[model samples]
Target chain A: MTQPRWLDQTEMAAWRAFLTTSHLLERRIEEQLKATAGLTHPQYEILVRLAAAPGRRLRMTELAEGVVASKSALTYQVGRLEEAGLVERTTCPDDDRGVLAVLTPAGAELLEKVAPGHLEIVREYLIDRLSREELRAMTSAMRKTEAALRSG
Target chain B: MTQPRWLDQTEMAAWRAFLTTSHLLERRIEEQLKATAGLTHPQYEILVRLAAAPGRRLRMTELAEGVVASKSALTYQVGRLEEAGLVERTTCPDDDRGVLAVLTPAGAELLEKVAPGHLEIVREYLIDRLSREELRAMTSAMRKTEAALRSG
Candidate 1:
């Protein structure tokens, strides 16, 4: 058996803090989004990504990557969103076999309507809670973490 | 429609950082736990909570609250764990109507086996990636965020 590498005081504290912050923020945001717009956070992210794209459309593979979801999960989610008249998938011109997820006008409208409440919840749980210095430090720390995770 | 209250550049940057960091870390941790120990992070958390409780047991309601799961979800999860022989649910002696989730020896053993890998991923993606000052700032920031979430 390998040694049980336990966390020291500071590391344990930081890990606990990270866990609580992430879960609480996600729960609060998801609850409000579901209550108000009937959208999950991942759905919200998908719409946001498409809305930000050059033509308000992205290839399925790109959409899946942007949302951190598998292609099949993205397909199911996009299908639901489409059934709700929020988004539509079309064949990509650039790749004959590739599909594109396009934000419908209805989806754009819904997103615009939902953005305020989403940002408000974000503010209550995060933006308004932290000092500017803390925010800066957190952003920097996360960037480093992302880099480390990507490389190793 | 209320005003959009769009985020300023710094706030936007911090928010994006938080989103990416939280999602990537969660995905990485969950993937590793699932692959190595056949345990979801929530299941691991449940085991940990039970392991720490007196007699390695806790009421179902308390378990739900501690793990941020709904009662129904907790019931289903406990049922699955019980089926797997890692945990058992029994009527609480103090309250016949309430059920207790007890960590069986197998569950405790599984948690012990999983903890080191979990902590290693946590270190790689979080603790070891940030400076001490950054970790301290993040801890304080998360505490404030949690307090704000609880109050509202």
Candidate 2:
């Protein structure tokens, strides 16, 4: 048997902190989004991603990739959004088989209304907690980790 | 309505990277743990938490808190673990009303087998992806964020 290589104190601390922070932050975000915006975190992410897209629309595949969600999950959320008149799935102008998710006027308005509370919560729990250098380092670390995850 | 406090470009970049990286990393970890250990990430977490506790036992509440899982979720996962003979929920020796999760011999054995693969995956996907200084900064950022989340 190959000997198991263990994480030393530094590595272990980093991993534990990352794991704990991520779990707590995600739960807190979900709770606030649910209570304040009547949306789950994934649903909010879908809205944000669509809102940022050109013409406030994205191909289904592109939105799924942008949100880092599974196709089926994105479809489910989009369906719920459609029911709420927040988004409409339309036939893709660029591809016969593809569909697009476009933010509806109501959805954009809702997003606008929800933005203040959501940003406040995010700022309180995350952005405001970090020093300027820490924020930059976090951004860099995330990018590096994401690149490695993608390549590996 | 209060004006939305928008994230400036730097804040936006940091938030987006954090959101994207966390989502992708979680899915990847769950997928790998499922494939390599026949365990969900939470299940693996439960095992590790139990194994680290003194006498490899912890009360249901403490286990839930330690794993940051909800009571109902922990109960469901514990039931599965019990069925697999990986863990045993026994009446606490010191408190008749308290239930404890104890790592079974089988669970310890399985953890030993799964440790190397899991560690390698963690290193490849996360720990090794960062420079030492980046890891330290990440640790600090996570700690600060987690403390903020807890207090607020």
Candidate 3:
């Protein structure tokens, strides 16, 4: 195989910093959510996605895709959510094997209760940390990265 | 309680965009690593941390802390790595309950082989996507966020 063009020293530093930051930030957010809302970040993400989707529900496959998780992982997570009464799973009318996850009133209420704290953490850790210019730069950079990865 | 300050439209947009971009970027990196090196991002992170450590080994607790994973999760991951001949576990002489994870020569070789492609993907998705100013801004913002979370 040909030698791959690797990141230079500066680029390597930035990449490592970015990875470390991303991991730590995620852990902080998840820890806060677990303590305050009794929900994992992934669980909260699922609820938020369902709430945003039409009819406040999505098919299992669609939910998996939205969350970028495997079907089995989604199933296990949704099962836990269902047991907690935060979400409901229903058989899809069009396909028996298909299941739709719906955010229940209880789930919506839980999210509503947690939104303030979650938003506050987000503000403190992410939004407030960045200046206007930094925010714009970050968004632009992320978009470029996303586009490149999509093409690659 | 006082009315909690929620993210304004602009901040909300940035937050959501950041989340989406981060998730997609992780997925892209994981896919590339899986295809090229047969290693998940978390596994690669573990290997990298061990490789960077003195003697290319660390206690289970230390490894977990370094990787920001729970003990059980780290145990499971190390088990997988051991099965793959990438790592070995040995009882610590000083601490009976403590175990050391030592990187195998095969593991070090694999890391050396995969580092170039992995760094390239990271550069493509993160470092190269930002300008010098933007990179500085991101690093600064991340540092602030990390400090805030650590202090809080």
Candidate 4:
């Protein structure tokens, strides 16, 4: 059998550190959002996307892609948000399978209220921790990685 | 009410890119490992940690902390691994509440067999996608962020 090719020392360190940091950062954001906003990170992302879209609404497929979640998972999350009166779902005018997620005024208000604490957490754990050059590098790396994955 | 402190354009762009890339990268890694090794990313992490530990074993608490998982989640995961004969658990001599997780030779062999495919996925989605400077910046940023979280 051929020997396995492992990540070299530098590559291994970078990969492991990235994994750990991503895990911790996500958990921190989730916990903070849960505590202060009664929303999980994924749920908050959905709200943010809806708020950013024109008329504060998006098709379900668009919403799933925007939040980087599976269609089924997004469906469930959106259903819960709708149940909570934070969002409403309407059938798309162009397609029957298409469902649009619209942010309720309550949802927008909740997001506005939660933004301060969420931003504070982000500033503390992520933005404030990196230098300007580092931030730019990170963003560039992420975009590169995303493009590679899409092509591959 | 106090004024909301939100992320500026640069920070927001970086943050969103990071979030999307991290989520997609993890999904790709998990898909690759599951297909090639029949292991979830969390399970693979557990196996690798056990393999690296002295005596190929660590207490459940230590394992959870090392894997960055909650205790209940670790217990559930370990139970599944145990049923698959990939790992075994024994009571710690010093503490009855403590259980040591030991990697089976089978598990070590599995990881050895799977490491190449896993590393390839990591390379495609992460390591190879970044320039040398970007890689260094990422590692440094992660280290700083992790340190800040730990200290906080």
TM-score of 4: 0.96
- Candidate with the greatest TM-score versus the true structure: 4
What TM-score would every model get versus the actual structure? 0.94, 0.96, 0.84, 0.96
lDDT of 4 by residue, A11-88 (tens): 898998888888888888989999997898999999999999999999999999889899999999999999999999
Off by over 4 Å in 1: none
Native RMSD of candidate 4 (Å): 1.5
Compose the digit string of candidate 1's lDDT tens values, residues B1-152. Answer: 66767889999889878887787788898899999998888888889889989999999998887777788988888888998899998888988899989999889888888899999889878898789899999999988997777677
Clashing pairs in 3: none
- Estimate, for each residue in A29-86, the C-alpha lDDT of model 1 and write its tens digit: 9999999999999999999999999899999998887777888989999999999999
> For candidate 2, lDDT tens digit of each residue in A69-115?
89999889999999999999889877889998999999999998887
Candidates 2 and 3, the one with greater TM-score: 2
* Backbone atom clashes (below 3 Å) for every candidate: 0, 0, 0, 0
Residue-level lDDT of model 3, residues A32-105, one tens digit each, is 99999889998998998998999999999898877767789899999999999999998899899888899999
Off by over 4 Å in 2: A1-3, B1-3
What does the lDDT read for residue A124 in candidate 3?
A: 78
> Between prediction 1 and prediction 2, which has the larger lDDT?
2
Ranking by lDDT: 4, 2, 1, 3
Can you list each candidate's DockQ?
Answer: 0.74, 0.80, 0.58, 0.80
Supply the global lDDT for candidate 3. Answer: 0.85
TM-score order of candidates, top first: 4, 2, 1, 3
Q: What is the C-alpha RMSD of each candidate to the true structure, in Å?
A: 1.7, 1.5, 3.0, 1.5
